[model samples]
Target: MQITVKLFATFREGRFKQADRDYPIGTTVANVVDDLAIVPSEIGMIFVKGRAAEMDYVLKENDALALFPLLGGG
Candidate 1:
């Protein structure tokens, strides 16, 4: 299936801000992250279809996913 990924802030600095990728059926968020080399340090928040999603979340065709870099606000 194909999915859209959006990167934010520093995540976009070192990675793809938007992309369309293909994966086998039943692929999970973590699976895609790994495939795209999206390390934990590059992921601040993750959203799937406008909602927060866990790493184990499964990705569907045409899903709009966003990954933001973690901000340190003290």
Candidate 2:
């Protein structure tokens, strides 16, 4: 199984912001976050397959996953 991941915002400075990586099938979006050693607070938005996805979303091979920081005002 293989997954391509894209990291944005502060996540880029972490040890898991690689453009792509390989993980076992049935990996959830949250698993990817965990692999990156990312804390929940640092995580903003999650886009799976071009749509807003929850952490429980089961990731499929070749699925495009994107992570971004939560938008804030002021």
Candidate 3:
């Protein structure tokens, strides 16, 4: 399956802001996170097609995923 991944905030450091990636049919959000070496604790949000999703959420072909990192400011 082919999915579009978008990264935000600190998550984009040394990585792309967005990209199209290929994965197997059963790939989950957690699998992509791990593949990108993103620490789960650092994730602030996960969205699939503009809707909130969990780490275990299974991906579908042409799905768009957005990952945001925890933001801290005063």
Please give, for residues 15-57, the per-residue lDDT of candidate 3 as tens digits.
9999999999999999999999999999999999999999999
Question: Could you estimate the TM-score for every candidate?
Answer: 0.83, 0.85, 0.94
Query: Poorest 10 consecutive residues of model 2 by lDDT?
Result: 11-20
Single out the weakest 10-residue window by summed lDDT for candidate 1: 8-17
- Output the better candidate (2/3) by TM-score: 3
For model 3, the local distance difference test gives 0.96
lDDT ranking, best first: 3, 2, 1
lDDT of 1 by residue, 13-40 (tens): 6677799888888988888788877786
Report how far residue 31 has shifted in candidate 2, in Å. 0.7
The most accurate candidate by TM-score is: 3
The ten-residue window of minimal lDDT in model 3 covers 64-73
Off-target runs (Cα >4 Å) in candidate 3 are 72-74
User: Which pairs clash (backbone N, Cα, C closer than 3 Å) in model 1?
Assistant: none
Rank order (by TM-score, best first): 3, 2, 1
TM-score winner, 1 or 3? 3
* CA error at residue 56 for candidate 1, angstroms: 0.4
lDDT of 2 by residue, 2-68 (tens): 7889887788884556566898878999888898888877778999889999899999888989988
Candidate 1 yields a Cα-based lDDT of 0.82
* Residue runs of model 2 more than 4 Å from their true location after superposition: 16-18, 72-74
